[model samples]
Target: MRKLIAISSGILLLALSLAWWMNSRQPQPVELMPILTGQPEYCVTCHSDLPEISASHPVETFGCVSCHGGERLALDADLAHSTMRGGANPSDLSVAEISCGGSSCHTGSEADDRDHIQRVMTSVQSTYAGAIANIRYTFGAQTDLTAHQGINAITDERTQTGITALEIFNPTLESNPMIQKFGEECFTCHINAVPREGESYTRQTGCAACHSTEQHQLTTAISYTQCNTCHNRGNYDLRTMTFVERTDHLTNRLEEYYQPIAQFTQCEYTLDCVDCHTRSEVMGDGDLHSNQKDIQYVQCKTCHGTLTELPLTKTLTDPNDIAFRMAFLKPVVDLKLGDTILVTEQGEPLWNTRVLPDGTYEMIGKATKQKFNFRPVMGTACEQKPNEQESHFCHECHAVER
Candidate 1:
């Protein structure tokens, strides 16, 4: 009987060991999409209100795996969100300085770092005004113009050509006193913040916000021609079409009085503002304007000219296809260091230029095609100041006296 008891005990021990081995050999469960990065999943639980706005937090939409570049699963939020360390927290403090903007993907320009941070903070903290006019104007004015699509547009195709009608001149006016007068729900786009759901007819649209513009006063479908209706175009002392010049001296020396097309009856002349004015921003394919001293060197010969030649002058055209008579108006072109343009004299073409576009090319005198494909000629004629030779015109660069 003792011998039988010992055998039975040995059999029981063997069976228990086999069961434990089978359990240990089973496969572990697998996960599909892991939350492997910063506390994005945590941050989005609160900030998913507007995913479309680019200026707003964009990483939250990319999911956790795109940024974290590590293991997905963690036992708790502390382990999931904490930076990985080999052992205990290391002596290196560099990990503490890591930020959303500090990432290689979002580094703003050196000059714009502080401003970008302030703008981001303002977006996070302040309540937006729910005014429709303010909303439209803000989007219309502040949307990224480099994308070649204005805020008001649904699609943008002209980005490559560098031309678009959508203009967002100044973006920070939301902080102005006029914006504050309407109270918390000042702009409808910011309704996410205030959550007011009433359909009252009294709420003003895009008019009130634009009417308050101190410069480039926008009207609801207001024709560019009627600008002089409330403005004194010539005196330059009083308001010109709702734009009050801030300084005593005008920056654009080449600016003649702007004549809006809507007011013209039998005039047979219409000019787009771009034909005279340079875009404040620089670009590669399109014409640009400069506010500094007018010089032939900085004019239309900048971009169109090949490396070996200068550009020839061509007749200027208005938006309406009317050929501007040389006697009536001069064509202006921007000239940079390397461009190509046509230089013409008395209905004859002369040289093509090698510089890119920078300053305006306004017709000052009539010179027939004399020199064929001349390199930047010296001692050109002068319109305003004559004593200076015109090889590298514009005192901003050459510094020669007129």
Candidate 2:
């Protein structure tokens, strides 16, 4: 009975102490966040603590209103995002003109820094009409493969190529059942195709296919994984010579598959697609190419270097080109070739390249800072064709005994 009484008193004391502490403390004041300067947006009030999207798209300079169209002064979520384009992704074709293009970002010639919108429209990847026409022709539904068989973008004449008529799958137009079925089932890979709900970022339509590296984020360093989302899908029906839809099968690394048009290359497992393919090739040459082969001009010899002559890299008179100067922050190997200057995508010349003692032409990636060594095949025991420079001929050294 004595111990129980003492325990009750202790509990009463503890409760009184907690009440006293609670009574002593006053309510803290809420510190209001400040709006961002320059652009005059209140988005920074919330997203100020958030990480910057990328080095290029600085929030302080670009602000929220530039790429993502939103009410700068509004505090409410719905009001701020009321007129936003492409939701979280402004680079989408539907709103890309006002977002990514305009007179500012990515709006000049493809050779220049501002031609993404111009180049991509005519790119083979953007236009699935060629592929659709070819398949229909092969299946005997169409007489030839020159017809435009997909929804076409209304672009300028310079940007537009081949046929510009907007087309979809039509059973009535195509007499052959296979051609009819082909249009209905397999017509959504083009740039115009809107993203289905809950699709992967890589499978997204339009600029998102390459630029939107993540689900909602964008980046310059795109990986090969995204390329596989579209390229690795489906298969060819050898007997019928028709492309048939197949399930997206993810297998172990050992059981790998590649596009049959390309030779079974060592680079298949070794390098990323972007490593070999240049910006002009993938982004496009500002031409409406019939196929991917027409645009992709980077040969094995380009990177590996010719067997005999060495490429030169020289200095320029002045830093006239602002874009190139920014891209070339530092030299890779710093191996100076002759006196000729090396130019980047902008056609502005680069400097500070050197040749290694091993006879390899060492150069830095224009903007990526990637180190490259172009080995001259002239001295090597390579059984290349007479002036032939295909990858299949170069990959003979790593040929498996199969």
Candidate 3:
């Protein structure tokens, strides 16, 4: 009995020694106390391999806990992620206010152009008001083409279009079969909606839907491919109230850029969408618009002047001009004080464009970073009518065939 007890004690001693040696070989936990939060966090111990989120958001200052809520001191994987906001996507609208909101952040004064969250929430893309209005009117659910409902209920006290509020549109409650089918089958293209299951429709929700790439990094240099995920991947079949994916393979960039029925100019297919569309046009102007037409006002004449006058030019005199701020965010072009750039009819500056010393306008592509020199239609031998200056009229003469 004494010999057996001695052997058992030796075995237990060897096991304890082996356990201590294995633990010593492992890497130690790394703790970080961010300047913004001033709270100690152990997230880096597990996520040390992740790249910095962006130049605007530094890991050293923000740390992981500030943006991604979790057990800052937890070492176990499940415990650390148990309270995380939005799981893998913290910028989701459902929790974006908690994750990315403040007066200095995305939700702030509209005069400073910092009210991103409010603008996006009321944008036509989020509301889906236009499609709902059209379908409801066509199916006799409503009397006119005016929008009376949105995907979600929203209110805007300062709406310029007199559409102060919209009741939540529950298509399931409608009596029309077509309206009910629209609710069941045709409601996935909105910014908050989960994209259809496919590689072409791959995208995140809310702000990350447009700002984040597959590398888990945020960027402002968005490409046409990213927009294609939601816009050009497929078309909805109104007859059947279903979505039909594009099946025809294209042979060239122009063919791939737009649908076969589209008539676009060379620059339309060449430049990315962000190059032409202003921030207010795409992100909403803090107003509750009924349809896209009410929001989008950029025309061919916005960049290229009419035959009588050059495009509207505004010289950058203030150091705190919004154009400088926009250029700093994208960084594709260098804009300086006294440099004259084109402005939209609504007075939004085209920060990526500049008037050269030779009197020609030079535009830097927002995504491709390519330089393009263009002359206003005033000097060219173009016969565009003054009143008929819409882009579709220009396409009648300059549109490239698919």
Best by lDDT: 3
Residues 61-141, model 2: lDDT tens digits = 777777788877776679988988888767777787788886557786544456878777666676665676677778876
Question: What global local distance difference test value does model 1 have?
Answer: 0.28
Error of 2 at 394 (Å): 3.1
Q: Against the hidden reference, what TM-scores do the models get?
A: 0.21, 0.70, 0.95
| Clashing residue pairs found in predicted model 3 | none
Please provide, for model 3 over 172-222, each residue's C-alpha lDDT reduced to its tens digit, 9 standing for 90 to 100.
789999999999888888888888998878989888888886656887888
By lDDT, highest first, what's the ranking? 3, 2, 1
lDDT of each structure? 0.28, 0.58, 0.88
List candidate 3 stretches off by more than 4 Å: 1-27
Better of 1 and 2 by lDDT: 2
Tens-digit lDDT track of model 1 for 202-250: 1111211211122212222222233222222322211121222223332
Worst-scoring 10-residue span by lDDT in model 3: 248-257
